[model samples]
Target chain A: MRGGAIAILAWATVLLVLFIGNWIWDAKPVNAATAAFAAVVTYATGVALWLARREALRPGPPAPRSEPESVPQSSLAAVLIGLSVGTILFGLAWANFLVYFGAGILVLSLGRLVLELRSERATRRRLLGEEEPR
Target chain B: MSVATAPRARLARRGGWPEALTSTDHKQIGLNLGACSLFFFLLGGVFALILRTQLAQSNMQVLSDNSYNEIFTMHGSTMIYLFVTPMAVAMATYLVPLQIGAVRLSAPRLSLAGFWTWLAGGLVMESSWLTADGAGRTGWSSYVPMSNSTNTPGVGQDLWVIGVILVALGLTAMSICVTVTVARRRAPGMALLRMPVFTWTALLSVLMIVAAFPMLILAMTLLFIDRTGAGHIYTGFAGAIDYQDLFWFFGHPVVYVMFFPYLGGAAEAVAVNAHKRWFGYTAFVVSIMMFSALSMAVWSHHMYTTGGVTNQYFAFTSTLLLVPAGIEYFDMIGTLIGGAIVLRASMLFALTFFLQFLVGGLSGVFVASPVLDYHAYGTYIVVAHFHYTLFAGSIFGFFAAAYHWFPKLTGALLREGLGKLQLAVMVIGTNLTFFPMFFLGNDGMPRRVSRYPTHPEWGTLNLLETIGAGIIALGVLIFLINVIVSLRRRIVAGDDPWLGHTLEWATTSPPPPLNFEAPLPPVRSYAPLLDLREQQLDRERRLEGAPA
Candidate 1:
């Protein structure tokens, strides 16, 4: 929607001001670093949104859409990827062999995730083609 | 022009656990996350009961010191990381898209992955109990020096550190999805400001989560490395103070992360039951932004006694928070005045949330002052203060949401009578359990102790608190029973039960996979359904007045 980037940017500016105040008052390196990092991350997100669409910074509701949107029903690859990461971390604390096993799963899941994305794009294309007036 | 939905082709429509676990639908993901959070809530409650039992009388020896330490740490950790914060996210994930008339979340697959990762983190954290030593005993904050490799060395603590990292990582990923959805997925007319009250609150919450949670991940990851002797990353006095700074940076905003969504839910419940649009909508939105921003800046208030930070700066920021806090209360009161107020269970809980949170907020102001905090810190007063806020306040708001949205979530109305009874019992139990701690804390009783030397007043109050904890448990049990009985009886809730004001009510109860099956009502205002009703009423009035 319009102004989404503006809102984020505005809030990030407020955080930056607060962080500046913190730096001036406390001057502790760790505290300053933490505040600075948060501010930067927020500002970076705002900038990314702005760059994605200039309209995101303008003020109004979004325009009505005509494009078809793909909605995936299920993503087993996503679940597997999540479990793999968790398993890899858990293995670090518990066992070494499990880490290798989780890595293998992660690789397979990534491949499946690519397949899902390609399929989703094809579904969107099909929907668009069906709607094209012959 | 209407938005068009593309059909799924290749994905198999499987049922049972596979579908439940792998579904990328925001609603399903939300429900899965919420169910897990509720389970953690009961788990956390059991931990609370154990703590209360141990503290019932001085030198009771209900559990050994080490065991007590583990229980208390897990109690705080489970409730914050697993229950309250995740519940807020679950509510937002499930309802924000529906409320804003979005078809689905941005990055749905990522959100699903986040859910699984978070669940695994919780399991890993709890699995610490099965270890040779025990679960984490260094408290939820897990400061350095005290939590260093030499002092509190164990695999359990290591697992806790890793678990916290995963939880933070997962929550961050999910929060990013919510944030992106809000920014990009609004219905045609649902502008940034015109998004419903709950969506605004949820937006702020996810933003805060995105801005703050990474610090926790960094803090935990470094703690793990420090614990494993990879590096003396946190060393000496500076290390301790640095760790606190890092932890509380995430820590303080998290309190609001646990709060804002529930507050939004309660606000919606109040407005709907009162049969009025939310009061001072622009002011309310602005205040929450200020409130959340101030919350991030005030983290060092927790470190005031440590003498490593500027007390005045933090205190000033913390005190400034009262301004926004006051605005919200004023808006709530303004909304209630001269409206068609209904004393539904949800409405009562909403009112109770405001009242109980006032107690917590006022107490917070006291501790926000360095002079006052010098006396209150590490005492039962601090414990009482936060419990009033987090438990009495946020949990009550959560219930308000539950009661208001239960129909929408499940297509069944929860038994009102049982709900009212549960509310009554919970209120009494909550007050009884937490109120006495203020008195006990003022009398110089320190917190985090398994045993204390016997004094009549302390003993009696602790006993009262233990009994109150039991009563609270009973109240929760009543609620569970109410849920079961209501679901079984199946009091079918129609599409627009309670004449709800938002876009979500325009759809069927337990909404379709795409959220809305019908074209969304024109979002001329935040409450599109209310706008439609008012327009209809105006038309009827004009026709009646005309000289036909």
Candidate 2:
């Protein structure tokens, strides 16, 4: 995974260099904007990757973790959040009331998301407690 | 800590339609996305059939010019925005985690949310047909001033703008999640270069999406504003050029976004059936990175004929693409050389994918030149080039993936007989449908017109294309029948049916809720399973040599 980050960074660097060339050669505003956006995204992602793990900057293989991980099965809040976003956007083009309706639903879904996260954390803690040495 | 003391025995509910709809499981989200994509594919295919019918004979009254324009626009939009691009994300969402030996997707909820957002966007786009003015009638690119409210005034055009914005948003979100999952979830010792070929391609694709999709979202938003009379955002020649610049930035890279994953799938199928690791793995990776970069840089080549963009720079970048593309062909041939090869349905499709895409790529070289593009732009030659790449190239690669991964997704093998028949039909149909357009294009037939003057050879060629379109439809029907038949009377495929190299094959067919139930094998190289096989064979040979 760390290696993947470095690879992306390397690719990003190449794109950034090419972007500079594109800028100097023909200074089209749109071209400069696109190049700038791509460069910033790549650079920001590289920084994020480095922050996530400094080793991403100099990677070979990922370090293994021995701990058991708990994975959730489903989330209703997620589904609602998705539907609400679509509804809000669709409403913007189609009807006004739907936009408000979607926003309300979105708020409720976010609240539900919090609850779901809390439940997941509780389950994880209990499982961890059971696995601890007596 | 207080929350930890609360009820921890509560489990997420399971088993029902609601569960199916709301499930955050990456596999479910992927399958859902795929199902929707297939539905859109059929709808888009119907649109194409109608279009071909209209074009079968000169000045046919099958559809009015207005209706014809709408259908063609919808056809291109449905296929590009709904089917191919989302399908790429679908594969990534499903396979990336399993390939990397992760139990769940990173940000699974976000992925689920993205799926619905995208699905809703597809529905809204289609819903434009119900409008009083009809659907978005501009070509899929929807060039401004023409697409401006003054020119194409309608609720439908507004819907189209909003639909594209939502689609971009959804796909972008999902792609980011896939990228993060690949970046964070790889199993220990699975170095980046040692990752499976498919994962590497998927990673590159999602990264390209991350870089490019924002431009699309911004384009659609501004287009919406331009349409709604908020401001005369795109006014004159400069405005049109600016629109093209923005549109093509997303537009060109989106082509590769649609290509790379299926290319990965085909490459994997070829390598597995050839009984070898992919040849030139490091070179292949570097080539794809260059390919993606060059693709981004080459966006203005699409705008070269407009004379707004730097023709030489774009041409250079576009022509340079041949380098990476040529290396890919070389690597594929190298993998097939001196190897025990099997002509399975998957392998056949994969091989054909390469052979057919070459036609598209070579034709693309013709248009990359400024002089040639002036002749080819807005003609059927351009149409033929893209259809070859997208349909003949990507769709075939997609089927190779379907044949390769179907057994893993469902615990049954697709019927080999039906698979081969479908491939044969599609190959014949696809060429018949698109190959003639090259001649028509060269001979000076303009595109996006509902009618043409009754020229002698033109009618005959168009008739052939129409017939070919029907054959393509028949091929798709056969594939559907094959899938249904395979599922009903199942031949149970156990884990690792193809002796697959990736971690996904290490799990059970139709993997369990958390993907893998057993501990994963040691991550030795890119082809970990193949590594295990070689180690066992070496051990057996060593034992036989020892004195008993």
Candidate 3:
């Protein structure tokens, strides 16, 4: 749930700023086509990532307790908030820069999820080694 | 085992080079192949640098078009046929048996025969380079009409035709040995999936060569027959592109055949250097197989702009090629995804290869689109594209594997710092040189031209490219220096310096006439040596706790 919320807020903040930046750059506003393309890519990727992360954190999942000792959820939430707020600030005038940063974070977030999965696998292997064989 | 060595046990080292030449021992044969391939590798590299230097500038004729053609042809022919293929074959004959618990290659005599034929063919091809018409001027692809007698004259091209067919025959013979050894000689417990990825790649490579080279032989023979005026085979209604169809029937798959071993070599090297098991061994192996099969289907991609071929069909196949190619990317990235990353000379080369081959592969995708193919085909863009594929994909893989295995082959570690410097320069110089050609090609520079006409605004890119060529030459020279110095001054590396898991590391630094005394036991996992190391640590810990 938290992952999805973070992803939505982050995605919206970045998109809103980029749209406004185009608003400022053009005589009226940037065309629907280019902005639409970027928005569609960003939003789809963001939502997918958020849903995946939220599924991982759900109580019934095998990894329900996996994040318990890792990073504090509150801190992750704080970081997400800061990024969302910063995007809202610079999203207009610095639309290009925001796009780069947002895309990077998007990719990095996906990578972190992957690394978490790998670590879980490694842990299961170690745990298997510790158990007595039948 | 005791048949031949008993006689020469006393007088063996006396004949030295001669004994090595006449040796039927698998190791000596391997050593010979390794040494000769190394010699040719450097030679091909020099040809490449010289050609690059020529194309670096607009055209004062450091070399003419024909000379450029010969140099490029020989460069490719030398690297793929003489150097890389034979080297891999040699490694297979020498190492795989040891790794697989075999006493020797399936038939050592056939291997020796293969070697002699290969050496002779290499000599014949090399000699043609010095001849009047100057050695197979029709590019390595040697497309028809251009390669046809009506267009190209002289015995030199004929010799290339004959020599390649001969070498291809020899390679076919060697491939059978490799296949039999793998199939028959693996340790009792080693199943197909359990075989090392290198061996898997080797087996697949030999298979490709066997199937494809026969077609190449058939094509070359038809051409040879036409040249002698025996029949009007290529002289008929289809003319040269018929030969193009026939040749690329062999030509396109041959590219991956030459490269797959290097790719296999790189995968193994990356696993060894990373000190972790390859992340997805099965996926990686499957990807190689995918590339091999998909490779044949996509040959028409090369014919996209060949004037009369259907662009629509070629473009469709080329795009479909991306799936298998992308799977390889997935496997490659997966291999390194979570392992402990070690940034050594070999690892650095592997990483750079990943970066460069990705770009190269992507550009290949771009060229696959029919519209783009229409614009870029026959231009310098195509040259830029393949050079990227060859250098970044194949040659870079070669350097990574060579540096990684140099110790195992020679019992000496290459100077790592120098190796890294050479790799960096190569990476930088390669991009600087070839990247601009994409622009030049887009701006309307045709390949195979000595001088650009005054109009195209090609001056600056050409100049920049030439400068990069010089740097690349220096970088390659540095690699040569590393090899030379390592011969005398380098640190001695015993077997298993990198903790290699396969059976090759189960013997001495430089193994004797026979690679091993007892065959290595099979493994449940790829990292047999790692398991051994962990066991040793556990034993030591237990010993320390004893009440002694």
Which candidate's lDDT is highest? 1
The clash count for each model shown is: 0, 0, 1
Cα-based TM-score, every candidate: 0.96, 0.96, 0.74
lDDT (10s digit) by residue, model 1, range B66-161: 999999999999999999999999999999999988989999999999999999899999999999989999999998888877988788988898
**Backbone-clash count (model 2):** 0
Off by over 4 Å in 1: A49-65, B1-14, B546-548
**Preferred candidate (DockQ higher): 1 or 3:** 1
**Which pairs of residues collide in candidate 1?**
none
**Candidate 3 C-alpha error for residue B385, in Å:** 1.4
**A8-91, model 3: which lDDT tens digit per residue?**
334334444544443444322112232343345435544543454422221111211222121111112222322332332223
User: Where is model 2 more than 4 Å wrong at Cα?
Assistant: A54-68, B1-14, B546-548
lDDT for model 2 comes to 0.88
Q: Candidate 1: which docking quality band?
A: medium
- Greater-TM-score candidate between 1 and 3: 1
